[model samples]
Target: MDSIINSRNRCIFGCSLSRLLSSLDGVIQNELARREPSLYQWYSSNQNPLVVRTFVNTFENDRRFNSATAICSEGKPMDTSESDLSLLVLGLFCLAAITKLGSAKVSCQQFFSMVPDIIGRFMDMLLEFVPISKAYTLTKDIGLQREFLCNFGPRAAVPKFANDHGLEISFWIDLVQKQLLRALDREKIWSRLTTSETIEVLEKDLAIFGFFIALGRSTQVYLSSKSHTDSNDSINSIVRCDRCEF
Candidate 1:
């Protein structure tokens, strides 16, 4: 009896997760279609496992953008703002994962797991712009403390990117809220709570999801905006760099 009940619970949770993932996939596809037709083209054309792996590696150490800057007429590196660069890289990382993993295969856990890696990679790339003396300070200052990370980390810039493009991401908040409610109901846990208590519980849980959702709402906004003005074509070059070559 216990085994049967556990199995049922797993099935219910899995169904909810699958539904949420499908919704996320749709969001990603529509955004790619509307803003990054070039990236969409790349995503469609690529299918080899090796190529996918290489692209994933690009998420870590890819430096075509760094190289592109050296060739500019000024003969100096392009001065990318920390916020702008982080937004660009974060956008690429999220979109690349979607393309590589396929939307349905990307679990919610996997999606959130990228936050620390993104922050680490962003900080590594950011170090190039700052003095050696400040590197220690930077690490300690921005070190993965939850409050600062959620509010001021690379992912946080995603909200600003969304706002700049006149995009709405409140759908995510609504979807997450519903998912939380459904989970509580499925567990028969809501009976313990009064209406106010339910609201309080949900608000506490949803706060973290909301922070990340703001970041996810429009992950690749920077890529689209940058593609237009960067004559070096940094965005396309990064996406199609030799690292991703077949």
Candidate 2:
């Protein structure tokens, strides 16, 4: 009896798996592309994978924007502001993921088409998890901690970077809120979201921005604090201050 039941289940599983694999084949893909003409081009037209990968790497590492100095018209490296660097990081990471996932490997345009939906889901999750007063309290703690981290740091570099970090944090936070609003375009949608949603979005933004706050500000705080406090416990500390490459 057990063997008969097992054989029946195996047949069912095999058929389902075969169907799933067949669905991803070129015939169905071409049909999908024909139906949604703008979203998917013929996969045969893709650029070489090696070339795309190299271009992506170079684009992400372009140091001219990384530095505070602006690049010159004569091909000299130029100064970059903290805002520029933050923007560079955000753009490279997000767009690179999109290009790398394009039609060759995944349905790139399909994913891009779904970004608004994704943002809406993110807003929903934020509203569910964090309320207004709760968000305010979290933001206040982060703000104070960031301020303290900035003040006690021994070098000017720490303070300057923290100032830049603050600006970028605000930018991304505002960006998420605006994107969420744009996703829900109906007038009725705006009516559904009161100030509570606003506060929820801000708190959610702080949760993400808190990461950068730690990343850009930690070096100075560590160096200053380590000198006075944890000099003996070398194992618990970082040997060098550097940006996480991810």
Candidate 3:
């Protein structure tokens, strides 16, 4: 009976994982269609190249206008406020992922190979619209950015780049700790609550902290690797320069 139950649990877990991956795939596809409608239609319908290129150019122009409007409000309440920053980051990341996944679908390159470059490019573009300091601060306050980095591991592969651009891992971890403590304080206030209520509070708090911890770990790993790579490259460049001079 126990063996049967274990097998059932494994099957259920596998099914859930499959569903999650499928949902992620669907999200990528939908966002790609929205971002590059002409490309989507052309590929889907097997249309002519010249017409498709024109359509694509028009679509790109439209997207630039829309993105600019989203990044900067004209005559309206500026949409680039702190409240919308999280959503903007998520949207930009999603768009970058979609572009990489699209390339992967067409080419033989693995998705992993394209993710870091795509994310880096997206971050660069996004920084132009919103200051990195604001982005980091907002991400630190809420745990969403950490959660995102944890979810997309390869996207977190360039910690030095992020740090160089002003995202401090220590600062983010400290913020997460503060948030966790606040949650604990709230839980303490409800100490007289029922067992289920206590459990719920604890679970929510753990979820938030766990996300930050995972993000911190990933960032640390990426930064260490990046630092090593940069060091080695610099040494090699120096050696080449010395040889040429000699």
Tell me the spans in candidate 2 whose CA falls farther than 4 Å from its real position: 1-48, 63-110, 119-246
- Each model's lDDT comes to 0.42, 0.39, 0.45
User: Which one wins by TM-score: 2 or 3?
Assistant: 3
| Per-residue lDDT of 178 in model 3 | 51
Clashing pairs in 1: none
- Candidate 3 stretches with Cα past 4 Å from truth are 1-113, 124-130, 136-246
Put the candidates in TM-score order, highest first.
Answer: 3, 1, 2
Q: Which runs of model 1 end up more than 4 angstroms from their true locations?
A: 1-107, 143-246
Residues 73-189, candidate 3, lDDT per residue (tens digit)? 446443333323333455444444455456547442343344444444434444444645465543334334543344433533335445454344333434444554565456543
Best by lDDT: 3
lDDT of 1 by residue, 127-153 (tens): 344532243344444333332234334
Best by TM-score: 3
- Candidate 2: residue 41 lDDT (0-100): 50
